[model samples]
Target: MRKKGFTLIELIISMAIIAILAAILVPNISSYIKKANNEKAKDIAAIVFSNSMRSYMKDGKFQREDVLNNINEDLNIKDNEVDVASLYDSEITVDFKVSKLEYEVKIDGEQSRYDFKQK
Candidate 1:
């Protein structure tokens, strides 16, 4: 004459297992999110660099204001999965060189730099 429901001990064990799994997964999930954001920032920065270079080639001059505007536009686009602009700590910096283009993207207080050499 035994019941078909789970015992109290079984329920407690299941709850404990769920809690342990959550503890293990939560931090990993957050870290992955941070990493993904960082990567997204990097991609945005690269695109900015590429667009600036193309504009420079087309116009025969590099405009800092235009580059900044492009950065804003790219980050604010509605198609983006994440609001990358919010993650940035400060305005992006672009440095134009005679034979190279350099840009820095700051996210979460870390700076990621990229260099593009002219061919």
Candidate 2:
């Protein structure tokens, strides 16, 4: 007479198969998340650049940290900061720099995604 349940060998084999599948899938999922974060960071960088340009035109100065909330109001963005933990592991910051005749917008921790000078 035999029991109806799976044998120990069968269960172990099934568990090993699941483990292998997880090993393969986990990294892929992580990579996908990182790619998504990079894409989001790029898009946000563009928005920040344009926002800075607009603010500079209207206010004669670059957007500063203190006025980020006001910019958020003008832009209707959810918040002054962004969180992309998959790539940056912290909230992304929108920083600005101004020279005599130009302003720069930088997304902290994500300089590679920034390209404000492009047409």
Candidate 3:
């Protein structure tokens, strides 16, 4: 009589297929994860820039330290959750123009940059 369960050769073939599929997928998954992190960093930069502009409008001046503190408070984010400051390489810059305010932030490792102008 034929065996009711998978034979040794059948099991080996199945395991080999699984391993091949995993090898193909693992690198793709890691690249996707890296892209997601970059996007997240960009989003964080936007938030920081917006907050800086808002603080400037409210107080008539840009205060980096104050804006960061307010961001932590308003977002209810603790240091352990995510260090928002660490996402960027340097501080946000605000330039005053005749009719608009320009803000720029550089992402960590110089991977990306965010610029916004408000009139």
lDDT for every model? 0.50, 0.49, 0.53
Question: Candidate 1: where are CA atoms >4 Å away?
Answer: 64-119
Candidate 1's C-alpha lDDT? 0.50
Model 1's C-alpha root-mean-square deviation from the true structure amounts to 11.0
User: Residue-wise lDDT of candidate 3 within 26-85, one digit each (tens)?
Assistant: 999989886665565555557766665565566555455666676676655454433333
Q: Model 2: clashing residue pairs? A: none
Full ranking by TM-score: 2, 3, 1
TM-score of 2: 0.60
Determine which window of 10 residues in candidate 2 has minimal summed lDDT.
82-91
- Give the poorly placed runs of model 3, Cα more than 4 Å off: 80-119
Candidate 2 ranges with C-alpha deviation above 4 Å: 63-67, 74-93, 96-104, 107-119
